[model samples]
Target chain A: MNEGTTVLITGATGFIGGRLVEMLAGRARVRALVSAYTRTSRIARYPVEMVRGDIRDEAAVAQAARGVDVIFHCAYGSRGTPEEKRAITVGGTKNVIAAARASGARLVHLSTQMVYGTPEKGVITEELPRQEGGGTYAESKVEAENLVEAAAAAGLPATILQPTAVYGPWAPVWTVGVLARMREGKVPLVNGGEGACNAVYIDDVIQAMLLAARREGALGERFLVSAREPVSWRDFYGSYEEMLGFPATVPVRVEEAVEPQRRGRRWALPQLLELAREEPSVRSRLGNTFEGQLARRLAGPLFRRRSTPSRTPELDKLRRLRSKPELPVYRLSPTDASFYASTARVEIGKAQRLLGYEPGYDLRAGMELTGEWARWARLVPAKAEEQQAQQKRKGVEAQ
Target chain B: MMVGAGRAAESLHLPAAAMTAQVTTSVIADRNLERAREVARNYGVEQAVAGAEEGKAFADAAILALPHHLHARVARELLEAGLHVLVEKPLALTAAECAELGTIASERRLVLEVGMVRRRFPALRFVKRALERELLGGIRRVTLEEGMPFAWEVTSDFTFRRETGGGVLADSGIHVLDLLAWWFGELEPVAYSDDDMGGVEAEVQFTLRLPSGAPVEVELSRTRELRNSIIIEGERGSLEAGLAFGGALRLDIGEAPLLIGQAQPHASEAGGDYQNVRELFIEQLENFRDSIRGTSSPLVDASEAMVAVGLLERLRAMREPLELPWVTANTTRAA
Candidate 1:
C-alpha cells in the first residue's frame, strides 16, 4: 500500500486499533471509523482522519467506507446480553462487508486464536478447524471469521490474522492481571500447573498486520502471528518473580467444583450458557434447545468431560521459560546481582522470515527506561523486604 | 426584696409571669463554688453547676470548662456526682490523668466528652472523607502547619506552663497531631524535635512514618501569627485546607504540581470562633448521649484519644534532640 491509498479502520479508539492507526498513519492515508461510545480523545497529532459513527448502523459504515482502498474492521460489542454479541460480531461484519464491497475495499479482519480452544499437542496452525470454545467472545469471533470467508467467496478480497496474547506497554490484559498482581505479590498458578501460551508483543502484532496488508498473497488467507516460542504459565510467573527479585508463592488450590468456585465462576462457559438461556431472545436464535447445549457445542464434548490425570504427562512435557533468578545476598556478602539483565525472551525469527519485520524498539530496554518518575523514591530496603519474604517461601517449598 | 426581684426579672429577657416557663439559660462552672452562682447569674443560667461540692445538685449537665490542670479532677467529680460532663481540650493534664477520668466515666456509666473542636471543622472533615475513599490515592506524604500568636494565649497560668498540659504541644499541637493519626492510622514516630520557650515547647517539627512508609511532617508553634493548615500530597493529586482564614477549603484534583504558593484571604466576617466551638461541643455532647443510649458510639473515644496522647507524649519527649530508634508498634524489642 502507498501513501495515497486510504485505509478505513473501525474500532480505531480501542487499544489495538489505536496502535494500528499510528502504525499505518505515515504509511497510508488512514481513515479511522470510531464509534460514538468509544470516542474519547480528539485526534490532533496523528496523520489521520476521523469518522464518528456506530458500526451497527449500515449507513454510517457505508459513509465510513467511501473511497477507501482497505477496510480494517475491528469493531465488536454492543453492551447487551449474549444476543448482542451475535448482532455485533456477526451482523456487524455483514454490514461492514457490504460497505467494503460498495467501495471496492479489501478487508483485514482481526481474529483470535481462542477459536481453536485448548490445543491437544503441538502448535495449532491457521489450517486447523475451529474447535468448541467458551463464552460469547470466542463464539462471536468465529462467526465473524465465517462472515469474512463468505465475503471472500462473494469476491470481496479479505484476509484474517489471528494473534495470540498481545502484550506491551499499554496492554490491557497482561498489565492488570499478571504484572500488577505480580508487583503486589498476589499471583496464583493453577494446579501443579503448566499451561503453555504463545504471546507476541503488541508491536510485532501490528507489524504482522502491516506486512499482511501489503502482501497480495495474503488475501483470502489466514495467518498465525506469535512469538514462536511458548512459555508455560508456571515459568511466565517465574519471570515476573525474577523481575521483583523474589520467588512468588504458589497459590492455594481448592476443589474446582466447590460452592465458592461455583459462585464466582467469571468467564466460565457453563455460567455464560446459563445466562444465555435465561434470555428469551438469545434462546430463540439457538432454536430454544435445552440450556447448556450451546456451551457444550462451543466448548466441545472433550472439555465437558472431566480432565483427568491422564493428561498430566502431556502437560508436564511443556518447558517452563528460564529466567535469571535473584542472586542470594546479604549486605556484607559479594553478590552477582549486578551481572543480571532483566529480559523477557521472544522469538522474532518467524516474524522476520515470514513478514520481513524488524522491531524498531528494543522492547526490554524501552520497558526499563521510560518517562519521568523518580526511582530513588522507591527505597531499596522496602523492595528487599518483599524479596526476602518470597525467597523464604521458595526455601520452604524446596525443603 | 420585691424591687430587686423585678430588676432581676427585667434583666433576664422574659416577661415576669412567664419567667418560670422554659428558661433560656447559660452556665459556667469552674472549681470555685463561691463563683459558680455569680458566674451562672451573670451568664443567664438559672443556676450555676459547680465542679466542687454542693453545687452539683442544681444542674442537669455540668460543663467543666476549666483549665487543663483542673480537667481530670473536676471531670471525675462531676461524673461521680452522676451528671454528664464536657471537659476542655487535652482532656486532662497528663495521659494518666486522662485515663483516670475515662475510668470514672465508665464506672458511673455517665457521658464524658473532650472538646476537640477541629474534628467538626469543615476543611478537616472534607480532607478525612477524601482519604477514606482513597480519592487521593494512598497519601504519600502529609504536612500540617499550625500556630497561634502569644496574644491569643491570654491566660498566663496552666496554659503557658509545662506541668499543666499548657505547652504548645498539649494545647495547639493536639489538633494537628490528632488530624494526622486520624488521616493515616497507625503512624510511628520517625523523627521529632522542638524548641522550648522557657521549658515549654514553643515550636516543634517532626516526621511520622505511615504504614505505607510515607512521611507525615508536622510543624507547630505558639509564636506565629495565627495559622492552621494541612497539605496532603497523594499519588495523582494534592489537597490543601486552611482553618485560620475564612474557614475556606479548596481541593485541586489533578497533576498540577505542588501548588504551594496559592494564598488564601483572611476574612474577619467569616465566622466567630466560639460559635464554631459551641457547635462542636454540642455535637460531642449528642455523641456522648447517643453512646449512653446505645444508639451510636463516641467519635473520638477513649481508646482513639489515648493513641493520640501517646503520639503527643513521644513527640514531646523527642524534643530534647537525640537520635531515637524507630519505635513501631511491633518493635518492642528495639524499645
Candidate 2:
C-alpha cells in the first residue's frame, strides 16, 4: 500500500518528525515542511523535498500540498501565546486541511494525549470529553484537534493519532531532560512521584503514525496511542538507572516546597475575570490573561514555601493543610509537583483494535534504543564503548 | 566570538560549514573546552580553543553563538580585526546596534550575514518566486503566525534572560519576521500587543501593513501551541507555507489549492541537492562566501537583519503588557 504513494511530512526536523522522515525514506515519495531554525542533522540523511515557510501561510501550505497522496501532519507548536498558538494550531491545521482537500490527499495527524488533560484518576480514552482547562499547551492542542475534526466532518480524509508521554532518540524534552536531571542528582518526587505515566517509545509512535496512514478505518477516526504497560513516575526513573546499570539514586520527596497550600482564606470565583474587572468590555481591566490567572489561582492551591504558622484562624487552617519539604532542584519547581501529581495512564485500545498497533519495545528495550540514540546524538553519556556494545547483546527486561 | 556550544552550533553552523565548497571550520570556540573539542572532532576542525580571544584568533569569520546581548560588542571587535562575521538572528538586542553592525561590515568590506536561514530554503525561495511571478495576483493581506511550546533543552542561561536578548520575540519572532520582510517588504506596524507578564513575551500579535497598503497580521509566541506557517492573501488567490518541516509552499488560484512547487533542498550551487538541512545552511554559507569573494551579496545581509530587529524593537515598544500567574514550568532543560 505504501508503494508509489506521494506523501508530505511536516515538522520533519523535530524529534518525531525527524524519525518519520527516516522511517518513510525508502517507503514512499516524501515532501518535508520544516522551520527556519531546523537543523540539517535529522533531515539531511533522507531524500525528501524540504520546503521552508510558516504553516500559518495558506499559500505555502497549498504549495507543499500539491501532488501528494497522503500527508503525515506531524508538526504542531506547544509553547507560544494564546493568539499565536490559535493561529498555528487551529489556523495551521485549517491550512493543511485545505491543502489536503484541494489535492484530494489523506492526512495522518500527530496529536497528543494532553487533549484529554492528563486525567488525574484513571486511564483516559478517546471517548472522554476534552478538558475545558488543560493549560495553554494542552488547550491549544484541543483547539487544533477540533479543527481537524471539523475538517473530517466536511469530508476531508484525515486521522488523528494522539500519543502519550513519548521518549526516545532526540527527544530533547522528555528522554534527555529526565536523564540529565537524574544523573545530576536532581530527581525529585512530587506528591511522592507515585502518579501513573503512560510512555510510548518514539519508534513505536512512528509505527502507529505510519499504520494510521495506510489503514482505511483510521480515516475520520481518532485513536489513542500508548504502550501496553503503564508505570509510575518513580518506576520510570528507576528503569532508567537499571538499564544504565547505575546504582539506584533515591528520589527526593519535594511535596511541601512545591505544592500549593489549600486551606488558607477562601472566596467565591465562578468567573475569574469577571471578578477582576468591574466592566464587561474586552478591553476592561480584566483581560483574558488576567481572568486566566485569577481563575486558575482561585481554583488551585496557593503554592508557597512552608513556614511557621501565624496561629490566626485562617492561617492555622492553611498551616494544617500544608507542610514543608526539601527542594532538590530549582528546575523541578512547583509546576512539576502539579504535573507529577496529575499524571494518569492513557488507554490505547482504539489504536490497537483499529490500526493493529502494538508496541514492539518494552520500557527496557525502548530505553536501550533511546540510550543508544541519545549517546550517538551526544545527549547522554556513554560510560564505555564496552557498555555500548553490551546493548546489542542484551534482551528485554524480565516482565 | 562564538560564545556557546549549543544546538545552533552543533546541529547547524558547523555541519553547514563542512558542506561549503571552500569553507571549512578553522576554529571551535566555547567556554567549555570539552564541548568545543568534541564538536571540533566531530567536524574535523583543526583547532579547538576556549574563552573569547583564543577562539576568535583562528577563524577569519566567527559565527557568534554567544548570547544575544553580546553580539554587537563581539562583532565590532572581530570587524576591527579585519574579520568577517556571521551573527545568529536578532542581530543584537536592539535596532540601532544592528544598523551599526551593518555599517561596520560595509566599511570593512567584510561579509556580515545574519543566519536567517529560511531565505536559503528553495521552497520558501520558490514562494518568493511565485509571488514575483504574480501567481497570487496582487498582494492584499499577509499573516505570519508561528508558535511552539518552549521545550528546547537549552542549558544556556542567556536564552532565558530578557536583558541578554532572550525570550520568544528575540528567539522565535525574529526568524518569522525576517521571512516576512523577505516576501512582503518591511512590514510597518499599525498596532501591537503581547502577553509578556514582566518576563520575555510568550506571545505577541502585530497589526501590520505590507508594502503598498496590504494589511498584514503577525503572531509570535513561546507560551501557547500551534503550527508554524504563513498565509498570504492576494488579489487573484492565496498562498500557504508550512514552516514546520523545512518548509512546504503551496499556491491556489481560484480553484482548489494547487501544489505548484516545492523546496529544492539545494540551490544547485549548494553542491548538488545535499541530502540534509545542511543544504540550506550550506547555501547560506555559500552566500556568505560569495559575498566575501566579491561574487555576490549575502542572501540575508546585515541590513535585512536590521530590518527585522528594528521592527521587532518597535513592536516591543508598542506591546501592551499582560498580567498572569506565571507558572515556573521548567523554561529550559535541567542538564
Q: Tell me the deviation in Å of residue B254 in model 2.
A: 78
Candidate 1's fnat?
A: 0.00
Look at candidate 2 and tell me the lDDT of residue A147.
84
**Chain B TM-score by candidate, in order shown:** 0.74, 0.86
Which residue ranges in model 1 land beyond 4 Å of their true spot? A37-39, A42-45, A179-185, A191-193, A239-399, B1-335
Best by lDDT: 2
Residue range A1-399, candidate 1, lDDT tens digits: 667889998878665786676556556788877654213221212445667677878998999899998898777764688897678887788889999899998888888776765444455666678865446777888988988988888787888878777665344565334555544433434332244546665666676777767676777777776765656655555544545555542422222211222344563657644643454322222221222244446766654353233334442332111211121111100111110111222334544555565543232422232100101112112245556986785455323
Cα error, residue A328 of model 2, in Å, equals: 2.6
How high is each candidate's TM-score? 0.41, 0.46
lDDT of 2 by residue, A240-305 (tens): 665445532333344332322331233234333243343222111121222334544575343122
